[model samples]
Target: MSHHTLPRPGASVFVYEWPVRLWHWANALFILVLIVSGWFIARPLPTMQIGEATHQFVMGYIRFAHFAAGQLLTVGFLGRIYWAFVGNHHARQAFYLPLWQKSWWRDVLHEARWYAFLESRPGIHVGHNPLAQIAMFLFMVVGMTFMIVTGFALYAEGAQRGSLPDQLFGWLHDALGNSQLMHSLHHLGMYFVVIFMTAHIYLAIREDIMSRQTMVSTMINGYRSFKDDDAA
Candidate 1:
């Protein structure tokens, strides 16, 4: 090993703990359920006379799935926030950015360049890289909050004017002045999540193959293993 380096090849760091791993997979499953059910809710299936009309209740089940998954997602997000405080440093990475740090910003630019194919190698990171930190803060943190708020706000409409959901989230309709507008914004936010997920998967797989360390398995096993210690 080099004098500046602490370990040799195959050295690993315990980055993501069990709680973070569980939450990550659970959150992904919830998002998948929400997306599929929410899609059907947005553009429902054709009216099919299957058995009795009252017994069919197709759309009812879809909406219920969406709502149930949304509730689970909301609870999971809250748990994730709590874990951010008590879990490891890597667990807290998605929630904030160290904007005042010069080196951090420099690494962000470096990673951006690497993503753009302007750089040949990636910067090694035990947790998320600087650019990924920003993306997580924006998409997962801010975007999930937006979806949950608007989703419940829309749900509050169907939940009646005096129910608990309406009492907690009805202000959103008044704040926007038009419930339809709120729906449009919430629908648009789903696309943002889809885009971020696509990019995230591609980058993780690419880095696993081309970069100097493990990527996908890191989340599964909670160990970020380095292939070589050469600096980026």
Candidate 2:
């Protein structure tokens, strides 16, 4: 027990509540849908020569799916933000950095060492560790914001002059001055989300297998259980 520090690991901990878990699974589904539909929109399939353009409504369907997924993502993001305010302290973690706190950095360094294989065990955390928190803030929080803003702005372009999307994000048109630049940035944001998703999945699987604590199943069940009494 002496080795155990923050978030003593002898027993199970309710790390994520139902709201968090529900949002997580829904968000994951929406992201998957968005990625596939977004790809079709950005680089569409070759045109079919059998019929007129009006008969080939594939591109229209793809765009509609993309737009619907984007709306779901926006709604999920806003819901997650609301949860961060009224939910537990764990809920609020990924929203900010503890830059002014020395101990937090020390914990981050400790986690880094663990990742580098310099440490034998990982620090037990009911919520996200400092390093994980930073990743979440950067990729999930910031990345979501970038994707939503740019996506809506682009949507506003097709939505014509006075639609709601245009009304809200019309200023982006004047700021970017050109549609190509906006498209480029939005493409980059999607890539960022893809890369982040890859890393997040790998880490979750690795931690679930290697560490004494639960990882992959934690979000599924909303519980974090430790295999050992002493935490790293």
Candidate 3:
């Protein structure tokens, strides 16, 4: 008698949507290009006229692309924010919350130990690991806030002296001391973004290597191959 093999006990039921994946990679590329171009504009270290003109042109293009990409990223951010409130348990608070403080702390320590090569198993998670969750949240806040403030500042510069944009950011400009200060703050924030981006890519690559699963691919495909018994 022929025997039938049962299907796998459990498999991923949820996957990332096209919009989410597109937003992720597109935003990543846009931010990288923006950062590189922005840095040269902020500080022309090599002091070459040709480089300066090229930098200006590149930065101009980057600013336009950044604005367009920012809009797309904003849409993705808002959609995800809305989803957080109404999505499934896995996609809602569970994904954002730290599980339990003790558990999360333990996991944090486990991560530290794992990085130090002190733990044998080091525990893998399906969703963002605790450290990643926190960093991601911070990036979202800093990135969005910086974009809003700096964007308004730029708009204010082109507005009539007493117009709304001017009025709104005028005090901020004064408090910060000048347009130069605003520019500096905006530029500094990009450094934070770059640091976050570096860590994010490194961790994703590390996880993919260690787990034999594409951590980056999850953002693309939305579905990760989680173990049957893994908790959401």
Candidate 4:
């Protein structure tokens, strides 16, 4: 479950705390690094005979970047989960759905209408709107978990038998019974994360421009400022 605070119109509320903001930007950077390096790892550059073949390690560097980012992302996600327990109410929003509450469902529909242009004004939200909440749950929480599991499983294969990665996540390979299939699935999962990132950026900019409250700056400075005096 999650909670929301209703602030007076034209008031500025501290919504995202420092830890949340740091995780937001750091997660973005880590995902960006992972995506670029993962692509190159899938289709490496042609061999350049400029240096001794033994000395050239272009693919090695790319894989290292990918692996490092993956590990960082995993640790960051775990910390986010821990923060969900100890931080403010908003910090827990991404982890669960309040499906039993009719008000939550109504707000979800209201947000959908606003996004669809059926409504001129959006409802004020101190943290994520219901639609954005659901999106984050799906794309960031569930999607990231899927990627991490599959990613480490793939890494385990390269690490070989009796390695830490193999011990921790290698069962995934046995469960799937085909390494190429795992590769394909992991590649497909990357596209989903990319799609989410693109849509998230577009929506943040759109809301900042059209909504009556802060959007992008809230994530940066942790305060959500209302643009008008009308009460929700």
Q: Identify the candidate with maximal lDDT.
A: 4
Better of 2 and 3 by TM-score: 2
Off by over 4 Å in 3: 1-10, 13-17, 43-63, 89-100, 159-170, 212-214, 227-232
lDDT of each: 0.87, 0.86, 0.63, 0.91
- The better-scoring model by lDDT among 2 and 4 is 4
lDDT tens per residue, model 4, 5-45: 66667789888889899999999999999999999888887
What tens-digit string does per-residue lDDT give for candidate 1 at 1-232? 1122434567898889998999989999999898888888878888889989868889999999999999999999999999999998789988988988777888888889988899876667778888888889999999999999999999999998999999999999999999989988988988999998998899889889987778899999999898985643
Clash count in backbone of candidate 2: 0
For candidate 2, the TM-score is 0.93
Which pairs clash (backbone N, Cα, C closer than 3 Å) in model 1? none
Better of 1 and 2 by TM-score: 1
Per residue, candidate 2 scores C-alpha lDDT tens digits across 1-232 of: 1124445556778889888889889989999999899888889988767588767788889999999989988998999999999999788888998899887888899899999999997776777877889899999999999999999999999998999999999789799899899999998888898998998999989988887789888899988888875533
* Model 3 steric clash total: 1
Per-residue lDDT of candidate 3, residues 1-232 (tens digit): 0012212324553445555566567767767666765666666445335565645564456556655654565566677666666654445432354555676787777777877789755455656666676776677555656765685675577565799878886667777778877887788788788888888889888887774234776887787654434332
* Candidate rank order under TM-score: 4, 1, 2, 3
RMSD in Å for all candidates: 2.5, 2.3, 6.8, 1.8
| Native-to-model Cα distance after best TM-score fit, residue 79 in candidate 2, in Å | 0.8
Model 2: lDDT to the true structure: 0.86
